[model samples]
Target: MNKLFRCCGALALGLALAAGGALGAPTPAGFVRAQGTQFTLDGKPYRYVGANYWYGGLLATQGPAGKARLATELDFLKQHGVANLRVMVGAEGLSNGYQYRVLQPLQPTQGQFDERIMAGLDYLLAELGKRQMKAVLHFTNTWEWSGGLGQYLEWNGYTGQPLPKNPGYSWDKYRAYIAQFYTCTPCQDAVATYIRYVLARTNSLTHKKYVNDPAIMAWEIINEPRPMLPAATPAFEAWMKQTAALVKSIDPNHLLTTGSEGDIATDNDMAVYERLHADPHIDYLTIHIWPKNWGWFRDTATAKGFPAVLARTTAYVNKHAAEAQKLGKPLVVEEFGLPRDGQTFTPAATTALRDQYCGALFGMAKGNTPASRVIAGYNFWAFGGAARPVPGQVFWKPGDAYMGDPGGEEQGLNSVFDADQSTWAVIDQYSKTIR
Candidate 1:
C-alpha cells in the first residue's frame, strides 16, 4: 500500500524443531563491503538470495505460541537455503492510522524507549546469530506502518494535518509535508538519539553490541526513503548524506544503504541516483519494482493475463543494474513480486506466474543477463508463512497471524506462503545458482 516493499549446512539441514541451539553465526568475522559492483564477505564474493522477514524480531517472543511459529518459519527458510534476512527495526508509538500497527508504541512518548520491543530484537539477533545468518536491518519508513512519517510529524507538534487522501489534499502535498522530517530540528535530533540508542545497546541475548555484530550485514537509513516533491530534493539529499555519515561515524563495522527506490530522481534524471549514492558512506544500492502499483502489470483484484509484464520487469532490473555498475557498488533488486495466477488470496491459489517471474529474476542475479551478473540478489515483495488472516478480514487486527506483510497490502496478494511448494522449489533451485 505504501511502497514496493545466510549460510550453513549440517545443523541447518535438521528438522525445524530439532535444529534449535545451532551456535553463533558461522559467517566470516568481519562486515560486508562494496567491492566494485559486488559485495565481499571476508574478501569473497557475497552473492546470496535473501528473504524479507520484517516481522522477524516481533515474532521472537518468549511466549510459547509465537516462539513455536517463529521457529517453524525460520527453519523452513533455512532448510531451503535462505541466509540473508531483511528486517524492520522501525516502530513508533501507536497512532490513529487506519491500519493498526503490529509492533507499536516502541516510543510511548517522544524520546522514551520501549524495553519490550528491544528485547524482542535482542532475541531475534540471538537466534539469527545461532544460525549463522546475516541481516539487513532497516530503521525508519516513509509509509504509515511501523509509525513512520506521520508519527514523526505528530511528535513535533505539527498535528492534525491531512495526509494524501484526507479531505482535499493530494499525495505529493502530504509527502512534501512529511518532507519536513529532513530539516525539522527536533525530529532530526530524535532520530539521531534513536540511532545512537540502538547502535550502542548490547543485545540482551547475544551480549554483543549492535555495532560489532556481524549478524547484521547493513544498516538501512529508512525503507523506501525518497524526495516526494521537486523542491524537496536538496533537503532529502542533504539528509541522506548526513545520515549516512552519521551512521558510519558511529558504526564502522557494518555496511550502509539509503533504501531508496532507485528511480528517475526528482531532478528528472536517473543520474541523481548515482550521484546521491556517490557518497563513500553508501556501501550498496537497492531498487524496488512494483509491477502492480507502477502499472507495469494489472493486479488480479481487477484484471488478469499480463504476460508481457515480466518483460518490462527484466528491462527495469537491467537498467538499474547498469546504473549501479557505473557507481561501482553492488545492486540488489531487494523488492519485486507478481500476484498469483488468478490473484486469489485463498490458500489454494496457484503461483505459476509468480514462480516463472521469480525464476527469471533469479536467473539475472546468477549471471543470466546481457550485462552478466550486474545484480547480486533479489528479495521478493514478501513472504507470508504459516499464517492466514481471519477469514474475510479486510484490515489485519491485533493478534492475527504474522504474515510477512505490512498493513494495507491486500491480504495474500503478494505473500509467498509456506504451502506454496512451487514457489519454494523455485527458490531452492536458485539458492545454489544465485551467487
Candidate 2:
C-alpha cells in the first residue's frame, strides 16, 4: 500500500510540471504571478519594498544629464533593496498648455504619439531589466498632473478645455467633468487605441515587445480612478472590466491591477471596491492610504497625531486586506506617504515623523498576522532621488528638477530624497525583511 501511494504521488507531481509547474497555468519564468494571496516570481515567493518613481521614463527623455541621473537613481534604489517600482507609462497632451503637467507626454495629439517619449520609456525598461528590477507601469491617470483622463476627453471633443485646476474651475466642477470619461464612448475608444499602441510597442533598446518584457510586473489601468458619483459607478466598473480584458487579450504574460485607492476611490463603499477588483482579469488588489489627505492626521507634531494616524491607517489596510482575502488575491498598498517634519517642503528638513510612520506601516506587511500575509507588498509615495527642490519653489516649473511629487503638488512634499539616510535606514531594514 505504501509503494502504491508513493507511485501515485510521483505521477501527480509529473503531471503538474507538464501542465504548468504547480501554478496550474503556463507562466514563463521571471514573470510575477499572483497565486492565492501571494506573489510568485520564477515559482518562488517575491516581495519587496519599492518606490513611486512617476518621472522615471520622462527622465530618460532628457539629454545625457537626464539619462545619467536616471542611471544613478536606479542604482541607488537597487542598492537599498528596492527592486520594484511603480511608474507612469507616459503622460498626455502638450506641456505648454497646462501649468501643472509632466513634460514630454507620449500622446501629444489625439492619436499621434511622441516617439521620443516612447523611446525614453523603452530606455527606462531596458535599464530596469538589466538590474533585475520590476515595474508596475500605469498607462494613464485620473489626475490633471499627467494630462491623463481629462486629456482623452479633450481629444475626443467632449470639452473645449479639460478641467485642470485653473482659476475658474472648482474641485467639485473638476470631479464632475472628469467623471464624464466613464460614459463617453469616444473617450473610451481613444484610450483603447492608446492602450493597443503601447502594448504592441517593441522596446527600442532591448528588442523586446512591451507585452513580452519581464521587467514590467504589471500594467495599471489608471492612477486613482474614481467614479465621482453613484450614477457613474456602473460605467466605471464596465470601463475597468473592458480595459482589463483588452490588456489581457493583448498581453497575457504580465499581471493587471486597477490602480484603485480601495474604497476611497469607490465612493467610500467597500462592497464597490470588492466588486470592481473581483473581475477575473485583475490579478491582484491595490489600495492607497493617505492619512493627511484623508484627514486622519492633522497635527504638525508627530507625537500629537501619529497614534491616531497609525490606528486609522491600520484599520483601512486591514479592511481592504480582508476583502482581498475573500477575493483570493494579494493586496499591495502601492501609495502611502506622510510629509516632512512640520509638513515642510524642503529636503534639508527632518523626516522623523515620516520615518516613524513608514516603519510602522512596513511592519504591517512584514508581520506574521493574517493581514500581513495578505499584504504581499507596498511602495512608498515618492522617491525624490537626487533632485532637490529649488529654494522657495512651491510647485514644479519647466526647468525645475522632477521629484517624486508630481507637478500638481508641492515639489518637495512627501519626497524621499537620496540624502534621507534615516528614511533609507527604515526602508532598507524592512526591504530585507520582505524577502
Candidate 3:
C-alpha cells in the first residue's frame, strides 16, 4: 500500500494545517490535495505510478460481462501497484453518427445526457473507492476519437465536419476547424453544462456525490487540447483559465489540471505552456510525450533509433520539469508510451524496446536530478487488461474490445496487457521506488 499510494501521514494534522491556507477544508479524509509542488493525501506526499484506463467507465456500462472485466482489471492494477487511474468521465456526440467514435457516449446531444452511461461512471468510481485508489477524470477530449471539440463545433453549426479518419479532409483542415472551439461560445457553454452535471452527480452505487468522492484525484479540462496555431494562443489560454475557474467554483476539493501535451500542444512554445498553467485555478502541470508521433523514432531502425528517442524524451521532460518548478507546481507525465519492437501491433510481439524506454523514463521520476524531483507521477499510455485484440485487425471495428489505443489508433499499439509480463516487471521495479 505504501508503494502504491506513496503517502506518509504520520504527522498529518500538522502538515494539513500548514498546507490548509492554499487549500481549504471539507476535502474529505483521503482526497488528493496539491500542496506547493507535490500531491498530498491526508497531508502526506502522494506520488504514484498510474495507468490511463480511459474506457473503464464505458466498459462498466456493458452490464454483467463488462462489469466483471472492469472488476478483474481494477484488481489486477491494484495488485501491480497502480494506485491512480486517468479515466474519461464520458465521451460526447456519439449521436453525431460518426463512423468512428466512442460508443454509448454519456452526452450524445446538446444539453442532454444518457443516464445509463452516467451510472456506469458512478459504478467505476465506487469500485475505485473500494480499493482506495484515485482517479483523474477527463471531462471531454480535443480529438475526434471521442467526439470532442469537433463534435461541439458541429453542434454549434460550424462549417466542415470533423474528418479525423476521412479520406477527403486533411489533418490540417481538421485542426483548423476544431481550433475554433476555444472561441465558440455555445460549444463552450454546452461543455460547461456537461461539467456541472458530472460534478453535481451522486453515485448510484456508493450513494456519494461525485464532488465529495475521494476516489477522484482531479478533473482535467480536456484531453490534449491544443492551440493548433500561434494566433489562437490567446483564445486557448483564455478558455483554459475560464474553464479552470468554472470547475473550481463548483468543486474546490479536488485538484484541477490541463490535459496538455506540453509545448507540443502549445504551438511548440514553452512560454505558452507555462503561461497557461500559471493560472491560479490550474493546480498542476501535465505533459505528454509521443516519440513516434513526434518523429523521434521509427520501426525500421528501432534498435538504433532508441538512443536518440530516449535523449529527446529526457530533454523534453527536463524542460517541462524546470518550468513546472519555476511555476511552483508538481508535474505529471500523464501520457507517454512506445510501441512494441518492430512496431508490431500484436500482444504476441516482443516488447524489448518498449520496456527499455519505459524503464528509463520511470527511473527519472525517482532519480536524483532536480527536474526528476519535480515530477510527482506518471500514467503510461494505457492499460488493456484482459482485452484481446482481434486477429489481423489494424483499426478497431464495432465489436472489438477496447485497448490502450483509442478508436483512432491501431488496436494493440502501446497497450500494456495483462499477459505482458516483461513490461509489468519493468513497471513493478519502478513502482516500488516512488514512496
Which candidate leads the pack in lDDT?
Answer: 2
Segments of candidate 2 deviating more than 4 angstroms? 1-25, 160-165, 299-303
What are the per-residue Cα lDDT tens digits for candidate 3 across 310-407?
99999999999999889988899999998888888889999999999988888887645766657889999999999988988788778788888887
What's model 2's lDDT at 194? 94
| Per-model TM-score versus the true fold | 0.89, 0.94, 0.95
Which candidate model has the greater lDDT, 1 or 3?
Answer: 3
Backbone Cα, N, C clashes tallied per candidate: 5, 0, 0
Task: Give candidate 2's error at residue 360 in angstroms.
Answer: 0.7
Report, for every candidate in turn, its global Cα lDDT versus the true structure: 0.75, 0.87, 0.86
lDDT of 2 at 141: 91
Residue 398 lDDT (model 2) = 88
lDDT tens digits by residue: candidate 2, 1-435: 146643753464455345665455577778998867778787566777899999899888889999999999999999999989999988888866677888778888889999999999999999999999999999999888888888888877767444456767776777788889999998899899999999999999999988889999999999998998788888988998999999999999999999999898766898888887899999999999888877785556656888888888888888998998899888998999999988889988999889998999889876456687678799999999999998987988888888999887888988999999999999989999877
Q: What 10-residue stretch in candidate 3 is worst by lDDT? A: 1-10
Q: Tell me the TM-score of model 3.
A: 0.95
Model 1 scores a C-alpha lDDT of: 0.75
